[model samples]
Target: MTLVAYAGNLNNRANVWVSLLAEERRRRAVRAVAEQDHAAVWELVEAFMAFRSQSGVLTSVHTLRSYRTGVRQFLEYAAEHAVNVLRPGRDDAQRYINALVAGGKKVLTVRSRVAAAVTLYKALRWAEATEANPFEETFAPQDRMHALEKVPPYQERVVRRVLAAAQERIAQAQPDELDRATAVHTLLVVLAHGGLRIDEALNLEWKDIRLEDDELRLVVRSGKGRKSREVPLSRSAVEALRAYRALPRTRKHPPRKVFPFASRSSAMYHVRPLFDEHGVTDWRGFHALRKYMGSRLYENLEDFAAVAEVLGHANVNTTKAYVRVGNERARKVLRDW
Candidate 1:
């Protein structure tokens, strides 16, 4: 389909702006290409990314940022080695893979960068800017590490320590610092109990939470890939949230958001020290908590589908990575045997 046709189908106000922006970027790229400008390659990359954005194929800011960085690295390598960005050969792709391996990049990192390069070629093909995709047959090295070894879930004891630390902070907080202390503690509680992504938890509003039949539940309006789902809150999570809500509001009219922090970094700023202090060093912030919830659910339910539903994973395969066999479970099984 033509770029105009692809963009024309969008009717929403936000998408209309995206379409216009993509069109402008495409025009600039086309002009640069016609003028034989060296900068045409970069313009084309921007236009391609804009097209992806307008098409709704790439929505996550983090993914877009990572892809841009990967693509830029590849472009720099191509320029240095006299490889044509517009029509790179398979040999060039292999050389790039070799360079990445030689640079001591992790297997996953190499794969991610290669995937980014492949996606860039796909964009170029969609834009009709290129007919070749050198990355089509290229492959990154295999990951030899076991799945559990890659990202192990936090043990129950460690999770308890983290929660205890948060609770202690709340208890010890002075009158003026109570609001922030409570918010941080509750944020961690929701992540641990609800199994929600950090972004999902951060985006939650007061309206999204519901109390039915004395059970607390959360409505995730938009999750990864724009999917929505309902998550049942654990008793501990509910209690923490209830305590947070009961705190006296400093402002007569406060924001409807569950947490007071605006950005992920802000949330982390309050909780990272707690996490580090309590032995959560390897995994990314907040995600380890989600994995902890997932592991516990799987251990109790023994059903992948049920755990997947709670975790809002569309594919059970993705859920598998989140569920780990805890030491306690292993010990129980051995003791029974």
Candidate 2:
């Protein structure tokens, strides 16, 4: 299925995905598929995979890969049961879900797998390979409200120790790795202090950073849903970015991208080891930093709107989770009682 032809069926979502892939990759994908039965299915799958590989724009790359993997597993299972993935009925979808649940997969895993199946079936429906999305009618878990999973922010001491260690690592970098070290160090500061998502940091451009008259602002040009917002930079975060920008390699010919890392995951490639070195095993990755930022902003300022604006949370409900009382603080108070 040619991209133009596929785009006609996919509504706007396919067009967005296609634009994210380079022209060469999009054309290559269109030409790569062989003429066969269910060729459209393969073409759509290839297109989705290509989009997953190249663009972490709309969703995290890790999530895209996981969804693709789940979809492929369902395809294999369908082949064994003589079910046509392109034309699955509700019963066929239910059986697959039952198989997953029977195998003792967690509710979240089962829901993710079913969601992947629904995504593919939607593509098939667009391709006119099926009359409807079979997986749409299938039962799946609905207990995934993020509020229930909320926890207290990391202890203030641990937060300080992690940021301090990041700076120490940058100071210790070898000559050849100075730029890389600066990049990681800047990311640590921005993520923890600025509260930006991993992708937002990775997608930041030189044009988005404004350092005028000693005031610093980072504009997120393309946040979730392509929304744009400008966040004030913490003084320390600004200092860290300045130090990174001043590196010899950076000054020589600044890359269009502000961060040196290629992708979101690659940006944090060094973070795991750093966390381990700091003896902080329980620390969640970037989200923990964001939560800490959100919590502090609310606790200090007592402004829901301000916290929401800075964190880029579309709903105040999401913002409210960050303000929940810290576990360590609660323990300390109870220790005296």
**RMSD of each candidate relative to the true structure:** 5.4, 6.4
What is residue 281's positional error in candidate 2, in angstroms?
A: 1.9
Enumerate clash totals for all models, in the order shown.
0, 0
lDDT of 2 by residue, 1-337 (tens): 6445334333344454455445543343334222222334444654564444334235555566677777677777877787755445659989999999898887888988987777666554443445656765678756565542544566678788888887787789788877777777788888878889888888898789987756589999878767899899988888888887787754333478887677757766777667878899875777777888888787788788899999898998778876665664688899999
Candidate 2 global lDDT: 0.71
Candidate 1 least-lDDT 10 residues: 8-17
TM-score of predicted model 1?
Answer: 0.80
TM-score of 2: 0.77
Predicted structure with the largest TM-score when compared to the true one? 1
Q: Estimate each model's TM-score.
A: 0.80, 0.77
Which numbered prediction scores highest in lDDT against the true structure? 1
